[model samples]
Target: MRGFRPGLVPTLVVAVLVPLMVCLGFWQLSRGEYKRVLMQQYAERRVAPPMDSTELAQTTDPAFRVVELQGHFDVEHSILLDNRQHDGQVGVELLQPFLDRATGAWLLVNRGWLPWPDRRTPPVFSTPEQPVSVQAWVYVAPGATFQLHADPVAAPWPRLVTAIEPDKLWAELGRSGFSYELRQQGGPGAYRTDWPVVSMGPEKHLGYAVQWFAMAAALFGLFLYLGWHNAGRPHGKHHESNQHV
Candidate 1:
């Protein structure tokens, strides 16, 4: 207060911005921690032995859990998830209903991504008519599902959708099915089955947090410097007047 006089405008700007930047920095740290925990859970569940369809149906926390499936794909009502990209090429992920023979429960299985070079023609794919065994993992989205456009109410077979809702699909097909989607690991009916656990890693979040914090520090430093600089101007003028007298 003695030799520091911050202008009202600068004080107001710092008051509004500094707290906001600090809050954003902490929020990013929280997000980074959350992503770390999620990745750990995924690693643990993925390594465990694959369970059967009955066990899978009874599972409460089924994120990233492996499951063994013995079923035939219902190719007639396939769903092509739009806007999927792989290796810098535009593509769609193929999802189909598979009936588990052991438990008589239907499941929506994501086979894999397929490139659609020409929009005029549908992506080519085939289904195994006979019973086939495969291994897949339960895929629970980290956040709310996204859709560029809502699926039409009366969408026909081989539907093109931006999001996949297993419950809605099962209801439309009039079948009692598992509510979660199962992403195929590798088997007879899989194509490009490799999937990443998370889109953005924890390190990226940490980096963003650092940037926010740095910006807050820089702004606060500028505020302090301006306060001191303005205060010194009046003190220097008073010293000169006293010397003249």
Candidate 2:
């Protein structure tokens, strides 16, 4: 027992704890990095080469980003999705069908924002009956379902739709040829173009990661303290326990 020191316990615990904490920290960093890469991909896709919406329009996967759409607007089928906010303002997006006379294809154009007021219905839009050409980035709306039921059915046109999938929409309306689907182009010309670009929420995710790591570190510390060092115990519990054994 001569020259035995009491510091060894804390040192050993910290050695194990630090490595675990370090791994957790690195894991969160990696997640942040992955998010950054994805964001970069999104940005690059936006600026890469513009595509023809009618030609690229397919019944398969919903194409996302950088599509060129040119055709006449089918004003009759225009729909407004509720609850969209941009830059501290609330608004509704204008969605209309573009028909390519040559290919017989259709593209859904999300024209820009129209300021919305509190009302039972979306603001009415006067649409052009003649042929119109439109270009926009593409995106797919997420599918949403409740417990054992689909969400509510959408209103008939010039009506508001909630969580409508483009493909399902095309089928329901008997849509045909057109290229690219553009989202967030909500503004004038055809619709309001005032909506902000889509944010993948990298900052929010990184913040969440930090919170998780913090909780892990805190819980580890609390467990170590309670099980080994607290509860009216003396300062030399490790030494006493080790020596007594």
Candidate 3:
């Protein structure tokens, strides 16, 4: 009870901050668990046999599945993902629209990363004219980290963008397509497609949780120290005086 009474100001500050710190710690813990499950799913799905466009469309979540698609590249409308790097060189990633041979639906395919041979002009890329079967892993749209500017309005062919969103691309192209990107597996139209296994792993989340929890503990300790120090009690209260003068 004595420690609980940390005066009005200290009580209000502790009430607001201590709970906030504790909530953040638990939130990180939940994030760590979610990451653990996601990592497991990615590991298992990446090795499975590649799926066709129809099968891929039916699947609920297609983040990292290796898929096999028979399609012809829409070479004329190819776009470049700006500000990409390859082997310590500044460049861009080529993203081409694909016309699926089976379903006749359009899908965006990441060809690969290319160095900026000339920053002033766009590099010329050779695209296959014939129908080709491509094996690639499914990757969703660019996340918040990739975004530097607002999604541009209707732009010319071979657009340059800071972020890639399937819906936005479809809106610009005026066609329907799969909502995910295909990181070219092999064959023609390939670039540095190798990506990190996990964006943020469980270990990193756990470390963040530890930091939040530590802050909560430190806040609790400070509150206790303030209360104990502020309580009016003499160093030798018992021996000082038993009767008033």
Candidate 4:
């Protein structure tokens, strides 16, 4: 008859790791659901008529809402967001301040991704001298980034940065209400703006959850295979054989 016995070391490792793996699977499942809701919101709002900056001001959650603004691009004070990747090629994202002509408010606008000719030389871009109208989606800064040191926003015009720190930029520009960023629609001073609707879609998260669960299952199986022989006690014929020996 089979029994349920396992070695001390294997038992200890399994006890510690199995639960951790299962917990990771559950976490990924939750993350997947969150991503699903966010993607749904994006899809629904994609077709809605664009709201102007004044209308966008009243929005409680302004992320992903299509919006428009009449502004002049601050070409001299633009920033190049470094370490951006597109289509397996390394590049940077252009971020420039847009001075709203109607409200006289300045907000950051992400022009789009641009490929680097090389690391040393900065990419060249031309901005329109006259005031222009822009249509874009409202973007709330989503998360934080890891940085060894705080990026100096006051270093120079056309700043190169690892991440956007709106507060620092606002302070540098001496502008107040540096709240939301605009993800520009294809227009003048815009590049390839095909940003991902969802950074990690539900399918990707679900796949990760499956992988975590699979690892847990494999660990349990290993514990069983390694410990199986140690399970059953000696019985009947085996007992007799032991006595004879």
RMSD of each: 2.4, 6.8, 3.7, 3.0
Where is model 3 more than 4 Å wrong at Cα?
1-5, 83-90, 117-124, 141-148, 232-245
Where does model 2 exceed 4 Å of error?
A: 1-35, 54-65, 141-151, 177-180, 184-188, 194-200, 230-245
For residues 29-133, what per-residue lDDT tens digits would candidate 2 score against the true structure? 776677666556667877777665444644364444565544577777787866677776777777777666556677667776677876766586777666655
Q: Rank the candidates by TM-score, best first.
A: 1, 4, 3, 2
The number of clashing residue pairs in each candidate reads 0, 28, 1, 0
lDDT of model 1, residue 141: 84
Give lDDT: candidate 3, residue 62: 86
Indicate the residue-level lDDT of 220 in model 4. 95
What TM-score fits each model?
0.91, 0.68, 0.82, 0.89
* Alpha-carbon local distance difference test for all models: 0.90, 0.61, 0.79, 0.83
Candidate 4 residues lying further than 4 Å off, grouped into runs, are: 146-149, 232-244
- How many clashes in candidate 3? 1
Instruction: Using TM-score as the measure, name the better of candidate 1 and candidate 2.
Output: 1
Best-performing candidate as measured by TM-score: 1
- Please write out the lDDT profile of model 3 over residues 91-119, one tens digit for every residue: 88889899888888888898888778787
Sort by lDDT, top down from the best: 1, 4, 3, 2
lDDT of 4 by residue, 1-245 (tens): 35766877899999999999999999999989987888788888978888878876678888889887897988888889888888789998898988888777788889999998697887877788988888888765435676888787367877889978776778866887547677899987789899886567899889999999999999999998877767665657988999999
C-alpha lDDT of candidate 1 relative to the true structure? 0.90
Instruction: Pick the lDDT winner.
Output: 1
Of 3 and 4, which scores higher on lDDT?
Answer: 4
The lDDT of model 2 is 0.61
- TM-score of model 1 vs. true structure: 0.91
